[model samples]
Target: MDDMIAGGCQCGAIRYSLAGPLPPAYACHCGECKKQSASAFSMSIPLDYDQLQVEGTPISFTTTAFSGRAKHNFFCANCGTRLWHSGSIPPDSITLKVGSLDDSSGIAPQGHLWVSKKQAGIKLDQAIEQFDTQPDDVTEWRGNLGQNS
Candidate 1:
């Protein structure tokens, strides 16, 4: 990905620009993620909260994840397209949906999380590490990606 990337919702609303090194993408297979994404999993790239700039207002809903931590899900009010998620789950960073990127060309998930809640029939890459649940520390779970400073 570029040092700076741009993306938005399905419609024209809720545009965002991310500047700085983009983290490798990761997948979450928890039930809430599957339900919100309507897919086997939700793919996201974590960015420093200060590195992202969002334009236009997004309707947000707060809910607790399988981890029991609260999160605020942001979506386009017009088309209701899910965008990014923010909250206590990751603390200082916002989880930007990879699919929302204007160009997702070379982006791919580096690992999988919440595999314990993964739905049946879902298959994951055996090459990448899969966590039954969140690791004790993000650093241990994401390797160097968690070393962001």
Candidate 2:
């Protein structure tokens, strides 16, 4: 069993716990991600729906994803702090927002996506895997994360 980790929204209105060894996170540099994070990139940790336990109701909305599929965004209604998002990749998916973690000091994305849309003057880690666009090789992506996919 892995250690359990806790996280919450900015206003502490919505909290969540994920049964650990949290999966490796990836940095998304897509235009939408940049717009949402208001930064160079957004970090995300993918998890199976059952792995996360959340308290309090989170408001959500649907948006068109880079893949042209519906992506559901969940955020705290009170603080407007985005908690997580759901992509159609696995009907019941939850991609946790690393920024929401109470202690995210250790988060370092293992890979990068949508570098084609990355902002100017942004330099990525040469050690980790990177893709100009969405990577088609799932196994390679997992392997880059040190997971045996």
- lDDT winner among the candidates? 2
List model 2 lDDT by residue over 39-89, tens digit each: 898998887767878899888888998667789888899998887888653
Please provide, for model 1 over 25-139, each residue's C-alpha lDDT reduced to its tens digit, 9 standing for 90 to 100: 8898988789899998999887665777879987888998655777888889999899888874333667889888888888778888899999899888787777898777854
The residue pairs found clashing in candidate 1 are none
The backbone clash count of each candidate, in order, is: 0, 0
In model 2, the runs with Cα more than 4 Å from the true position are: 88-91, 137-144
* Global lDDT of each candidate: 0.80, 0.81
lDDT (Cα) of model 1: 0.80
Top candidate on TM-score is: 2
Tell me each candidate's RMSD, in Å, in order.
3.4, 2.9
